[model samples]
Target: MSTHTPGEDVPVRRIDRILAFMSLGLLVLSIVCFFAIMIGSASGADMSGGVWPLIGVVVYIAPIVAFALMLAVLIMSFVRRARANRGG
Candidate 1:
């Protein structure tokens, strides 16, 4: 290990499991909404002929993407820690 002190640049932190869990839940919900809207658009009703459906899709994607990105960061952090422990 180089002579760099841990707290100098990378500060110690706590992993908020509750926040992680909530993010995962939101991500799942958004994904479900995305698919639901997509299918509904493809099917009958033909609401607004399509404009409204596209708009709905955009609205749903934001939250889901945000949650997914947060999850990815958590996963990556875990993997990195594991690798460090194993001297990889």
Candidate 2:
């Protein structure tokens, strides 16, 4: 790492922050939904109506989208680091 002071660090790109936050939000949502489903099942609550189907869809889809977003963030981060190193 460079010896730059805290106030002089490399700036994070706006898109990178957005992608990272999106990934984090989706991941948290999926985990919450997964646990909700588990608790609902364990308590023998009805799983056939209301928010169950929506929760099920979120459980299935959120992780995949989160993973994709994380991958994108990683790629962008790497690219930015590489460019910085090369130019410096």
Candidate 3:
């Protein structure tokens, strides 16, 4: 009773793809920042100095925000596809 045939590819929206890419980029940046912070700390750099801690906080938070956005985009895409399939 399915409209789609077996082995058919499901189409993804452009916005969803863009959000996914953005999320991935944010995750990569977060990881790089984490390593940089660790190395800096190990090298006796003052984390509390000037803007370092602020940079650290923003980097740590970026992935969470990016992932949330990506999740929203994915859910919206899924709902839109479902509605379309239902002939709404």
Candidate 4:
């Protein structure tokens, strides 16, 4: 029989979980903003003619930032796993 305890199977770190939640939140926000921009443009709401357009640009960048954060978390998790395997 396996000797591992229940708690020992949890491989994800707390920080990783936090980062994941943050990434999810950013994804949701990006989706909402995308739809908003699409609907606004379709309705001839001047999406590209005012301050709202600047806000749209910021919203568009959120997913990119989220991706970078997730990539960092993945790299960190890999490094952690490697160190653990090395018995350090």
TM-score of each: 0.41, 0.78, 0.78, 0.75
- lDDT, candidate 1, at 82: 64
* lDDT per residue (tens digit) for residues 45-70 in model 1: 56666565665765577686666767
Residues 14-62, candidate 4, lDDT per residue (tens digit)?
8999998898898888888888877887888866577677668768788
Per-residue lDDT of 65 in model 3: 83
lDDT of each: 0.62, 0.88, 0.80, 0.79
Please name the candidate that would achieve the greatest lDDT relative to the true structure: 2
Residue 8 lDDT (model 4): 41
Which clashing pairs does model 3 show? Answer: none
Q: What tens-digit string does per-residue lDDT give for candidate 2 at 1-88?
A: 8664334335788998999899899999999999999999999989999999999999999999999999998888777776666665
lDDT of 3 by residue, 1-88 (tens): 8776444445787888888888888888888888888899899998888768876986879889888978888788778777766666
Q: The CA-based lDDT of model 3 is what?
A: 0.80
Better of 2 and 4 by TM-score: 2
| lDDT at 26, model 4 | 89
lDDT, residue 72, model 3: 88
Query: Which stretches of model 2 miss by more than 4 angstroms?
Result: 1-9
Deviation from native of the Cα of residue 50 in model 4, angstroms: 6.4
* lDDT minimum window of 10 residues, candidate 2: 2-11
TM-score of 2: 0.78
